[model samples]
Target chain A: MLSNKKTTNEKEIQKLIEELDNIISKKENILEINLDEKIRKLAELLSSSNSLEEINNCSEAIQRLAVIIFEKTKALKNRSGILYIDPFLMKLAILGSNIEKLSKAFIQSWRPVVGRDVINLFLLKDAMTYWNSITKYSFEAREEKTIENVSKISFLDERGINEEIEEMYNELERRGGKELYDKLIESKNLSEKIFKAVILSFMITYGYVGIIREPLKGKVWVVKKEKTIESKNPESFVIVVK
Target chain B: MEEESTKKLRRAAQLLFFKSHRNPGIKGWELRKALGQDYTKILKKLEEKINELGLTIKIVSDSGELRTLSDPHEVLSNCRFFISINDPLTITDLRTSGWSIDEIAGLTVCIATIISKEGKTTRQELEQILSQKLPKWKATRLLSKYIKAGYLDEKEDYIVLGWRTKSEVDLENIIRYIFS
Candidate 1:
C-alpha cells in the first residue's frame, strides 16, 4: 500500500510539476490565453483525443479541463438533486485527480453524451466502484471496523453486557416504569448508548420486561413480565399502570 | 489437512474471508500487497484446494477482485432464528429511521456498477457520483452509514462489497430485491 502510494504520489507530483511549469513559463508558452478559448481548445483536444490515456498524457489540457468541469459541476450543484456528469469530464477529473485505473482496457473510450446537461449518474457510480475498491483495500481496509474485530469486545462480554442491562432494569423497577424517552444511554458517547441499547433489547426480547410508550405523550411504562423468574437478581418489580 | 497447500489455503482464507463478506468486492492490486504481486496465482491455487476448509474463492469479473464464498445453505441452516431475530429487526429499525434506502441503494449501486464496469471503483468515486446525484447531505449520510453497516467497504481508493451481505443474503435475491 505504501509503495503504491509512492508510485501514485510520484505520478501526481510529476503531473502537478508539469502543470506548474506550464503555468510558470509565460514567455515560452502562451499561459495567459483567454479562458473561454482555452476551455474550447481543451474540449476540442478531448473530443479529438483517441484514448483516455492520450488525454491523460496531455497533463496541461487535463488540468485546464478540470477547471471548466469543476465550474460546470459547481454551478449544477445549486439544483436540489441531479448527479449528471459528462463522461469525458468525469474521465478528465479521474485523470487529472490521478486516480488509479481498475479497467483492463489501456484506454477507456468515453463517447460524449452530447446534447445533455446531465448524463446518466451511472458513470459516476462506475468510476466510484472501480476506484474505491483500489483505494479502500489498499489504504483504509485495516482501519475499517469488521465483525471479527468489533465482535472481539473483551471488556464487554456477554455476562458483562447482561449485568449492565440488569442495572437498567433495576432502575426502571425503582422508578415504577420511568417516563417515556428515557435515554437508554447513561454515557454521552453514541457508541456506549448503542451498546447499552442493544443489551437492553436482548433483555426485553427474552421476555423479562416490556415497555409501552404513549403515542402522543411520549411517556413509557415499563412492565415486568412473566419471565421475571429467569432473573438472577429477583426484585419486587412494578408493573406499568396503564 | 495441514499440508503446504492447506497452509496456503488457510493463509489466503484468513486474508480474503472478511473482505468478500459483502456486495462490492476487493480488487487484485489491493490484495497483491499482503499476498505479494503473484497473489493472483496463489489465489487460484487456493481456490483449487480450499473446499475442505468450508470456503471458496471467486473472481469478480468486472472489478477483477477476489472474494471468498460460503455456502448459503449452511449459513441459513446455522442461523438460530430465535436468538437472531434482531438481524431483520435491525434492518426494520434502520428503515423506520431512513437508513435502509442508503444501505440498500449503496449496495445496489455498487453491485450494479461492479456488473457495469466489470471492474472495481474507489469508494470516493462512488461517493463523488452519489454526491452529484443525490442531495449532498443525504449522500454523505448514506455513504457513512453504508460503510458502518458493513454493507459497503472502502478499499484502498475503491469501495467493494462487504462481508455482512455476503453472509446474510443471496446475491441474485438482492439484485431482484433492488429492481422490484
Candidate 2:
C-alpha cells in the first residue's frame, strides 16, 4: 500500500514538472509573470534537483495551481470577445458604438431624473401594448371572387369538393403555375371579403395552406404542400390554452 | 535553450490571460519587462491559439485590458441572462439565506433603481438611496455577498466592475433585440 501511494505521488510530481517545463520553454513570448503567492510558496517547497517525484506535498500544490490556471483560461475562452465581427454587423456596430458613446456623454452631463424615467418607461410599455392590441391585423382584404377563380382552376380531390378533379388539374398544370395567381387574385375587394380573408389567414397561419409571393412575377399564390409517403396524415388543429 | 524559451512563453500567456485577484488583466509594460524585449512575439503566439477559433484578444487602450472580439449579443450575453431584471441583489442574497420567496418579491425597489441610474455606485450611496426603502444592515449584508463573490468591486467607496464581471456585459443587446 505504501509503495502504491509513493507511485501515485511520483506520477503527480512528474506531471507537475512537465507542466512547469512547458510554461518555462516559451521564454521569448512570455512576459515576466507576477506569480501567485501560493504558486511561489509551492516553488520554494520543490527542489531544483531531480527526485521531485519522491515528494508527496508537491502533488497538492501543483494541482492547486493547475485548477487556478484552468479556471482563468476557461474564463478567457468563454469571453468569446476575441472575434472579428461579421461584415454586416460590424458596420452596424460602428454606428451603434458612436451612438452609445454620445448617449453616455449626454446622460453623464444631463444627470436625468430617475423617477421620471422609470415612470415614463412603465407608461411607454403600457402604451405600446395598447397600440399593438388596437392595430395588429391578420390579412389584407380580397374579394371572394378570387377564391371562386382559384376553385375553378385548382382541384382538391380528397373531400368530395371537386367535381372535375383530373380535368381541372390537367387544365391548370399545363400553364406551369403562372396562371395560378396572375389570372385568379387580380380582382379588388368586394363584399363579404372580411370573412373570406379571416378563413384564408387562419388556414395559412396554421400550416393548412401556404402563400408564396413571387417577386419575379409580382404576384402571390397559394400552394398546398401535399403529404409525402413518409408523412403521417395531419389531424385537424384544435387550439389549446392552458 | 529552446525548451526554456517555450516555457517562458507559456507562463507569460497564463499571466496575461488569467484574472488576478488584484487586477482584471496584465498590463503591456509588465509583459514587456518580463520577456526583456517586445511583447509582440508573445502576443503573436497567443493570437495563433485563438485565430482558428474566430477569436482574437483585443488590447483595449494602452492599459492592456484584454477582451475577446464578438458581436454585442455574444459579448457577455450570459451575464445579462443571469442577472434578473426585476429582483435586486438583496433579494437574491436573502433568498439564498433563509428568506422566503414571498419576502423577496416586496423589497424596496431602491437598490436596482439607484444602481441602474448611477452605473457605478458606492455602498454609502446605495444605503442612502434605500434609507427609506429597506433596513441599512440588510443592504450592507447583501452588498457584501456580491463583493465577496467578485460580482461587484467595492473600490474604496465606489462600486465598479468586479473581476468576475469584467466580461463587459450590457443591456445594449436587449435594446438591439427590442428595436430590431
Q: Where does model 1 sit among the CAPRI classes?
A: incorrect
Interface RMSD of 2: 24.2
TM-score, candidate 2, is 0.26
Instruction: List candidate 2 segments past 4 Å from native.
Output: A1-242, B1-5, B17-24, B51-118, B122-139, B155-158, B162-171, B174-180
- What's the distance in Å from true for residue A222, model 1? 46
Which digits, one per residue and each the tens of the lDDT, describe model 2 over residues A1-242? 66776566466566666655556554322223344654765565465324544555586557656755665565445334422123344334323433233233222221110111223343556556545433234243232424354444334322322333323333334555234433432235522233233334434444544444422122345454333122122223221111
Please give the RMSD of candidate 2 to the true structure. Answer: 25.3
What DockQ, on C-alphas, does every prediction get?
0.02, 0.02
Residue A107 displacement in candidate 1 (angstroms): 37
TM-score of each: 0.23, 0.26
Clashes of 1: 55
Question: What is candidate 2's lDDT per residue for B1-112, written digit by digit as tens?
Answer: 7887787778665555453212244444555566645455656675676556544444433221333323232332221111111211232343344434322211112222
